[model samples]
Target chain A: MTAPDPRLSINQATIKYAPLAEALHLTAGAGITSIGLWRDSVEAASLPEAARLLAGSGLRFSSLCRGGFFTVPEGPARRVAMDDNRRAIEETAQLAAAGAPGSAAVLVMVAGGIPQGSRDLVGARSMVEDALAELAPEAQAAGVRLALEPLHPMYASDRAVISTLGQALDLAAPFAPAVVGVVVDTFHVWWDPELTKQIARAGQEDRIASYQVCDWQTPLPADVLLARHYPGDGVIDFAAITADVQEAGYRGDIEVEIFNQEIWDTPPGTAIARTIEGFGSAVSPHLLQAGARR
Target chain B: MTAPDPRLSINQATIKYAPLAEALHLTAGAGITSIGLWRDSVEAASLPEAARLLAGSGLRFSSLCRGGFFTVPEGPARRVAMDDNRRAIEETAQLAAAGAPGSAAVLVMVAGGIPQGSRDLVGARSMVEDALAELAPEAQAAGVRLALEPLHPMYASDRAVISTLGQALDLAAPFAPAVVGVVVDTFHVWWDPELTKQIARAGQEDRIASYQVCDWQTPLPADVLLARHYPGDGVIDFAAITADVQEAGYRGDIEVEIFNQEIWDTPPGTAIARTIEGFGSAVSPHLLQAGARR
Candidate 1:
C-alpha cells in the first residue's frame, strides 16, 4: 500500500467548530503538517495569536479563505469591498511570512454573485475584472497571491458569477500568475464538462494556486452553502481528478474543505479522523507511487 | 406596440393541476392556439379522450412532455424503460394525428438521472446514446420527434445527466433532426456561459425541436424541480435569450413550462392568465413580427 500523502491538508472549514489554537494543536498532534484557514476563524482567535501558533507549530497555511465580492456596482460599497480585500491581502502576507519559508499562503477570491435586483451576469463578471486590475498590484507588492475560485453554477445567483474554471482562467489571464491564480475545489467544479482541459490549462499557465477536495452529495441540503460532504462520502471521482491534478504538476497541499452540518456536529477529533480517513481512501491511492499509475 | 406573438404556447405544466379538457378549453378560450402535453396528465385524462378533445378543440399539440428515462443501466429495467418510451412515441403520434395536420408533435426526452448505486455519468450518457440509436428508427417510423432536454447541472445527478445544450446537441447529432432534436429551456440553460453559442449551433443544425421558457428563481424551492418561476419573475434576461433563440431560427411554439407549487395552487384561469401576461410581457417584445424583426 502507498503511504499517506504528506501533501494532505485539512481546511478549518472541515471542522469549523474547532477553535483555531485548539485546531492547530489538534492538527499537529494528529500529525497533519498543513492547514487552510478561514478569515473569521483567524480573527476570532486573533490574527497575532493565530500567526504565532502557526509559526511555532510549523504548520503551512495552504490558503486564507476569501477576499473578493467585487460585484457592488461601484461607489462606497465597492470601495469598502476593495478595502476589505486589501486587508485580507495584508493578513495573507503576514501569515505567509510567519510560516516556514516557501509555503504559499494564498488568499482565495470568491468573485461575488450578481448584485441585488440585477440579472446582468456579464456586467457582474466585468466588475470582478475591474476589481482585479485594482487589487492585483497590491497583491503583488504584498507578496500574497489571490486565487479566484469558480463556485458551482448553483451559486451563480448568490455566491459567485465566475462559475467555470475556464472563465476564471480568462479573468486571471491578464494578471501575472504570482499575483492571480485559481482555486480548484472539487465540490464546485467536479460536474464541469471543461474541467479536465481547464485544469490542464491552469497547470500550463502555472495558475493552480490551491487544490481543494470535497465530495458532492445529492438532495443538496436546503442550505446549499453548507452541503459539502467529506471526500469519499459522495459521487465525485477523487482518484481520477487527483491523478489529473498530479499530472497537471500541482505538487501542493490537497485541502479537504467540507461544510456539512452533520460533519460540523461531530466532535472535532472524530470529524478530523473521518476527513483524514476519507482523504486516504479517496485520494491517497492516486498519488504517484513507485512510478506506477493506480 | 406589436401584437402578442401568435406562436406563444402554454405547456400544461404551467398550470399543472388543470384538468385536460378544461385546460384545452381554457387555453383556446384565452386565444392560445397551441398547448404542450404531459404524458401523466394525458394518461390520467386517458389517451383516447385526450385525442378526441384535441381533435375537436382546434388546439395544436405543440409537443409531448417527456418520453426518455434511458439512463437505467442495461438489464431488464433498461428494456422496460425503452418499451415505455416506445409507448410514449405511439401516444405522441396519435395526438399529433388528432391535432392540426402540420403540428410537429414532439416528445421531450429528459434523460434520467444517474442509475441507482452508480456515479458513472459517462456510462449513463452512453446508455442514453445507445438508447437513442435503438429508438430513433421507431421514432421516425411513428412520425414523432424526440427532443432531448438538458436539465440544469444541479439535476445532473438526480434528474438528467444531460446538463448542457452542447452535450444535448452532440447526442442528437447522430440522428436525423426530425427523429431527434433538443429542447432549449431557459430555466435549465440560462446559467450556461456557452448558451448563446450552443443555441446558434442548434439552429444551424436545424435540431431545435422545442423552445421552453420559465424564469430561474433562487433560494430554489426545497423541491428544486418545482422552483421554476413564470417569466418576468426572476433573474433571466428573456428579451436577450428569446431574441437569440429567434435568431437561431426557432419560429415554433414558445412554451411556458413552469413547475412552481404556488402557481399550481392558483386558480387555473388565474394561472393561465398570469402565464399569458408573463409571456407577453417578457417574450412578446423580442418576437419577429410580420416579416420584420421587433
Candidate 2:
C-alpha cells in the first residue's frame, strides 16, 4: 500500500465505535501519523492516560474534538457550560504537549444552536461571542487556540448558530490569532460562495487553526448529522478546496473527519485504510510541491 | 375571522394538492386578496382557463412559482430549459393581466443544482450567471422581473446554487433592477449572518422583488425539501425578518410559501386558515404602519 500522506490525520469521529487505544493503534497501524481526539473517548481514557497512549503511539495530536456549545442564556447552566469548556481547553493543552512535535494545540468550537425554546438567533449568536470573551483568556492562559468551526447552515438553527467562514473571522477578529482562530472544514464550508475569498482572508489573518477534510452528498441520511462521507465518495471538489487551503498557506495536518453511520460500522483498521487511500487520491496531490502531482 | 393582511399572498404550493381553480378559490374564499401561481398547475389548467378562473376568483396575481433550472450545460436540453422559462415568463404576463388590478409580473428563479455527475460547484454557479446574462434581456422584454431565490445552503449542491441573499444580489447586479431582482424567503435565508446588511443593500439597490415567509425548525423530516413550518409554529423570528423586509422598502406582496408534508396533507381551507392565523400573529404586527400593531 502507498504510504499515508504525511499531512493526513485521522479525526477520531471517523471510527466512532473505536475505543481510544484501538483508534490510535488502528490509525497508526494504517501508517497515519496523526489523530484528532474527541472529548468523550479522551475523558474515558482520562487526560493523563490518553496523553500517555498518544505519546506511545508516536502520533501527533492534531486537535481536540470540541469546546464551545455555550449558547445558553446567562445563568447556572451557562456557567456550567463555560466551566466544561475550560476543562476541555486544559485537556487540549495537555494532549498537544504529550504528542510528537508539531501537534496543534487547537480546540474545535461549535457555537451551540439557538437557545432552547428561543427564536432569538441573533441573541444566541451574541451569546457565542460572550462565551468567547469569557474563554479566550482561559484558552490563551492554557496555551490553546479555540478553533471556531462554522457548521453548515443546515445546522444553524439546531446545532450551531455560526454558519459561515466570514462570520467566524468576524468573531475571531477581536482576539489574537493564537488565542482564537477558525477551522476550515470542507464538509461544512464547501457550499459557501465566499469560501475562496474568506479562506484567503483567514490565511492573511493567520486564524486558520485547523483544516479538516470530508465530503458532502445529499439524500442526506435521515439524521442529517451523519451525512458526511469519505473524501472521494461524494461530489465535493477536493482539488479546488484543498488547493484553496494550500494557497492560503495552511501547511497543517489535514484531518479526515467523516460522520456517517456506515463508516462507523466498518472495522476501525479498515476505515483508517479507506481514509488513507481516499486522502491519498483526493487531497494529497493538492498538497504536493509544484510538478509533484501524485 | 380576522381579515388576512392586505399584503399577504397565498403561494399555491402551500396547498400542493389543490388544482389551480381550487387553490384560487380557497385563497380568495379565505379572504386572501393575492395568490402566487406554480407553473405546473397553471399549465395543467391551461393558462387561458386558469387566467379566466383567477379573474373570477377576484384574486390578484402575486408572482409565478418558477421559471429557472437553467444550470444545464450548453446543449439541446439547456435550450429546452431556457425555452421552458420563456414560456413561464409569458404565462406570468398573461396571468397578471387577467388578475385584479395591482397584480405583479414576477417570475421566481430557482438556479438548478450542479449538473449531473459534476463536482465543480463554481462552474455550476458560473452557469447560473451565464443563464442570467442570457435570459435577463428576454425577461426585461417580457416585463417580468426574474426574482432569483437563494435556497438554503443545504440545497446548494442539488437544488439551487445561489445560497445567500448577498450572492443573489451580486448575480442580479449586472441587469436592470426591474429585470433581475431577488426573492427573500425567510425559511431559506434566516440563518445568514449577513442577512440584515444584505437586506438593506437589496433595498438601496431596489432589488427586493419578493419577500416570502415560513418558519424553520430542527429534526427536519425524511425529505428535508419539505421541512418548512408555519410562521409562529417554529423557531424563526418572523418579526425581525418581516421588519427587515419592510424596512428594506419592500412594499410588494409578502407570500406565505411552505412545503411541509403535514401542511400539504391538511385540507386546503384548513391549511390556509392556519397560514392566515400564523401570519396574522407572527408577521402582520411588523408590517403595520407605526403604532398600528395588530
- The lDDT leader among the candidates is 2
Please give, for residues A40-68, the per-residue lDDT of candidate 2 as tens digits. Answer: 99999998999999999999999998898
Model 1, B150-181: lDDT tens digits are: 99888888788898899899999989998999
All candidates: CA RMSD (Å): 2.2, 1.9
Model 2 misplaced regions, further than 4 Å: A290-294, B290-294
In candidate 2, residue B184 scores what lDDT? 96
DockQ of each: 0.58, 0.84
Give the best candidate by DockQ: 2
- lDDT at residue B34 of model 1 (Cα atoms): 86
TM-score of 1: 0.95
Considering just chain B, what TM-score does every model have? 0.96, 0.97
lDDT of 1 by residue, A115-185 (tens): 99997877888999999999999999998999999998888888899988988999999999999999999
Candidate 1 residue pairs in clash (backbone atoms < 3 Å):
none
